[model samples]
Target: MNGLLRFSRGVDWVNAQVGKYIIWLILASTVVSGVNAVVRKLFNMSSNAFLEVQWYLFAAAFLVAAGYTLLHQEHVKIDVLSSRLSKRGQIWVDIIGFTFFLTPICLAILWYGIPFFLQGWRSGEMSNNAGGLVRWPVYAMIPLGFTLLMLQGWSELIKRIAFLQGRIEDPTAKRAEKSAEEELAESIRRLAEAEADAGKKAD
Candidate 1:
């Protein structure tokens, strides 16, 4: 159990790092889309490559961030029924869901996705759209993302079990952590204050 807990922590660390870095992909996608839109509207020019790259970035960010989303417990959930359960009951629900549903679905996706990626890579599959990017990279995300998600599911299972056994605190207890939005808002506020102070000094 101690060994398993260590493994769970390692998994959590991996997903945590992934979550931290994947935010940059979202920013990159936004930049790409904005640039593509500006170029098309202003220059009256565009390439399928430009259009295709936006969705490629989007797909990469969205698919690759699955485990990170799960790790943060940010994934949408129907809490209508489970919200009423006792703490232990809720943990059991998660364990069953992770074991029976989440893991199997991830496995099924990986079983199909790995071959899908392999076929595309072997054939050097390019986009049907002219000047578009190759397809295998996006295809590869399917398996890679699911594999991370599955590992996260196991980590969550370990945490829940350890909690039940009195080896750890409640697994569902959210950490006292501000969300990204909150952090960004705070940073913006500080920047605004700094600019205001600079203006006063200039005066």
Candidate 2:
């Protein structure tokens, strides 16, 4: 169990790092989209490659961040029923869900996705659209993303089991950390207050 806990922490750290870095992909995609739009509208010139690259980046960011999303517990959930359960019950529900539902789904995706990616790579698949990018890189994200998600699922299972065994604190407890938006809002509030204080001193 101790070894498993250490492995879980490692998985969590990997996902956390991946999630943090993947945010830059979003910015890159946004920039590409803006540039593509401008080039299309202003110069009346565009290529499928530009459009497809943007899509690839978007897909990469979305898919690669799955494990990270899970680590943060930010995934959507239907809490209508489960919200009523005790913490232990909720953890049990998660264990069952991860074991029965999430793990199988990820495995199935990987089973199909690997072949899909390999076929594209082996055949040197290109987009049907004019001047489009190669297909394998985008295809590859499916299996890669699912693998990360599956690993995180195992990490979560370990954490939950450890918690149940009195080896750790609540596995589901949210960290009391503010989001970037929240921190920015706080900074703005402080600036406004400081400005108001200066005005008061002047008066």
Candidate 3:
């Protein structure tokens, strides 16, 4: 169990790093979608292919970033009431909420999404719209996104258990700490620049 938890932590770390690459995809997809909308309105011509590509790109961006978002603890939280609790108290709440609510939903989504994508891929499914801009592989994102989300959920479960038992620190609460020496060095740089300017004015 201990080894498995460490392995999960490793996976989460890698997933978080990979998530950064999805930002470019998100930006490109958004630009394409916006351009498509403007072109359709101005020219009164439809480019169904552009529209389809936008959809696929959007899905790719979201699905790819899902694990990273969870790893960074950037997801929405309903911690209004829970924030006031003690460390042990929060652990209890997390365990209960995850076991009863989060785990089931993530598992179900992953289970259903796999078959959904497979069917679409097997049938070579295409857009039903007449003269649609593009025939997108719409089903690809569903399974991929949900699978990443499921893995993240499992990692969260493991981390929560470790935190409650005081075995390992809560992964989310850690911040990058800097040394006092680094701070002093930065202050010295600033002071030197200021003194140089003052001496130049006095000259």
Top candidate (TM-score): 1
**lDDT of all the models against the reference?**
0.87, 0.91, 0.72
Residues 35-153 of candidate 3 have per-residue lDDT tens digits of: 88888899987667787777778878777677767776667877888789887787777678767777788688878877877787787777777655323265667766766766777
In candidate 2 the C-alpha lDDT for residue 135 amounts to 95
Off by over 4 Å in 3: 37-44, 133-136, 174-203
- Ranking 1 against 2 by lDDT, winner: 2
TM per candidate comes to 0.88, 0.87, 0.75
Instruction: Name the lDDT value of residue 82 in candidate 3.
Output: 78
Off by over 4 Å in 2: 178-203
Instruction: Write one digit per residue (lDDT tens) for candidate 2, span 1-203.
Output: 99999999999999987876777677788899999999999999998998999989999989998998898899998799889998888999999999999999999999899999999999999999989999999999999899999999999999999999999998789999765346546766988999999999999
Model 1 lDDT per residue over 76-109, tens place: 8779999999889999999999999999999999
**Lowest summed-lDDT stretch of 10 residues in model 1?**
179-188
Clashing pairs in 3: 48-133, 48-134, 49-133, 49-134
Per-candidate count of clashing residue pairs (backbone under 3 Å):
0, 0, 4
- The clash number for model 3 is 4
Cα RMSD to the true fold for all candidates = 3.8, 6.4, 9.4
